[model samples]
Target: MNEELSARLRTAAEAHQPDRARILARLERGMSGAPDRHRESSGARPWPRVALASLAAAGILAGGGFAVAAIVQSPPARPDNSGTPAAPSAPSAPWTPPHTTPPAPTTGGPSAPDRSSSTSPSPEVSGGTVSARPDSAHVQDGPLWSAGSLDASSNTYWAQSDITLKTTQPLTALTVELRITQTGAVQSTGHWRTLPADDFTVTVQPEGAAVVYRWTLKPGRTVPAGQHVFAGQYNHAAGRREAKHDGYRVDATGPRGALSVWGGFTPAR
Candidate 1:
């Protein structure tokens, strides 16, 4: 029984050893092929890594191009002493002042005459008479006139005459003379000479107005002789009359008498 058991054990051991050898062979083949697969996987891994890196580099370059385009499109910066950019300045307007107006001018009227150089009044004469010789004659033997007595009539008589003197000299003196006579009744109580009343007036008609020289004569009055005997008598009537052309007039009033008048001028030197 023991021998039979040993034979059976030996046969079983032989069978198991063959099966185990086949399994070991299969494992060895699998192990040898593992290194080749690992090499292939490692090579494929490096290609994926290189492709990812290239994609990342292209994205970075595209971003840099966009940044440069933005910088080129923007405006240039103004320089300042500080590091900051300056703001733009606004435009200014013109300046002006307020306005004003001026005033207007005034006007006036005409003026008056000056009274400081007016002439004075004439002086009175004494009863005496004077004689004068003229250097030149103005009038001689003018017509005579008469006035009746105051009892017969009260009418006054006047005569006027014009004469021109020819001389190239200045005259300083003027004289007038008259011839007088009396007529009509004479008595012891009232003689014709005693009863007659007479008045004589001589006038110089210069350029402007008549200037009068007067004498009141008695029946037989005497006259003194001189130059410029009637010099200061002017405007004795205190009135103005029209002047003749370089001439004069005689005016007489009496009760009963006849009178004749003559006049001339004297040279200055």
Candidate 2:
């Protein structure tokens, strides 16, 4: 009978057709059979065997509970977006310092414009110059420069405070000539010309140097004041024609009187 009861309990546990009520019924039958044996043996039946069987059945139920718990706790696997296995934490990129290159040097200075290879003359305007060696020159206490202009407009000029030589030659045939460029450049060659006495003015001041007629710039109907013609050679030039001077001056009463002069005016085109 005990074997038959054990067989029934096993079938209830393993059978797919057995419901919860059937399994409970098999357990009740097995428990009742042991209690009856003890009652027939005057309360002394196989107690140890019954206890072992009960323990075995409890173990099977516990195992089923554990299996259900494992199914609920387990999580489904997911595909990784990155090809490589992701590290526990991505390390921060190495720190990089910014460039430390020095700034370009400044380009500011006080030099004249670059004209080493230039052949053009100086501009005929104020505060300007051409191909002059020194930035400025001095005038002697005697005659600085002389020019002739009859055009009745105003003339402009520049003069420095240095480089004037007292004339050693006597005033035998004192004919002063001045040369100036049409664009107001002071040339080294035939730019100088002698001025006719009528077209020029000579003012000899008592205090300082005397000023001969300076060139004057004017309109079409009028002639610059210093514009004139002289019939003699100037600085060993040919016979006279209409001529102009960069500037001109007469010596003061003193022996070393000189004039600082430069021509810097031009006729309008």
Candidate 3:
């Protein structure tokens, strides 16, 4: 009912045009005592009252026109949809799978080694690989289990020769010698043996144009039966040096007969 009444009001306001001049002229005439036909035909209504009524009606029409203009200009309100739930947020990111180790990257050349895929590239052989087992020689058999090799750290300027001996029986006497070929400016730098320092005599000397490092057990000093090392260190000219001509000798005597072993150093593979 209210909406219908508002519609009618708006229509009436739009159809009728208020005339200020005509209304004012009528008011002046009425005020001057000129009879108003409508007022007389209807019951005697004062001119002032009629003028006020006209003004009130004009004001009402002006207000209704302004209200209609506002209604037309304003944007429509959005319907309330907060009551409806939002679409289930994209299924909450597909259940993430547990982390797994990634595969190693493949290559055209030998695939770069991967610790995850295989074992870490065997720890880089330092300078080169040095065999731990000695190149066996029956030069003079002894309580065997002895080995020798050039150290892996050997480079152009320096090198180390290692002799590892594992004696099965105590020794009453022992002697070891390592010779370095007389290459460019070849010179003995040092020598070491696992036997107690005071138990053996160590010497590094040049013999017949070759530098020889020797370790000899002192009289009455019983060489213990176990693994022992006799390493000879030397310096030579700056270049890759080979120990093909270099050699070592080990002689020992225990409760059994005296025995000895001699062999040449093999270039590290």
TM-score for each predicted model, relative to the true structure: 0.18, 0.22, 0.48
The full ranking of all candidates by lDDT, starting with the best, is: 3, 2, 1
Q: Can you tell me which runs of candidate 1 are displaced by over 4 Å?
A: 1-45, 76-269
lDDT of 2 by residue, 199-251 (tens): 33432211112122222221122222222232111122232222332333222
Candidate 3 per-residue C-alpha lDDT over 102-141 given as tens digits, one digit per residue, 9 for 90 to 100: 9976676685556565221121111242111124354335
Error of 1 at 96 (Å): 9.1
Give me the candidate number with maximum lDDT: 3
TM-score, cand. 3 vs. native: 0.48
Ranking by TM-score: 3, 2, 1
TM-score winner, 2 or 3: 3
lDDT of 1 by residue, 180-235 (tens): 11111100111122211342233322211222333344334322221112222111
lDDT on C-alpha atoms for all candidate structures:
0.31, 0.35, 0.70
**C-alpha positional error of residue 168 in candidate 1 after TM-score superposition, expressed in Å:** 32
Worst 10 residues of 1 by lDDT: 181-190
Candidate closer to the true structure by lDDT (higher is better), 2 or 3: 3
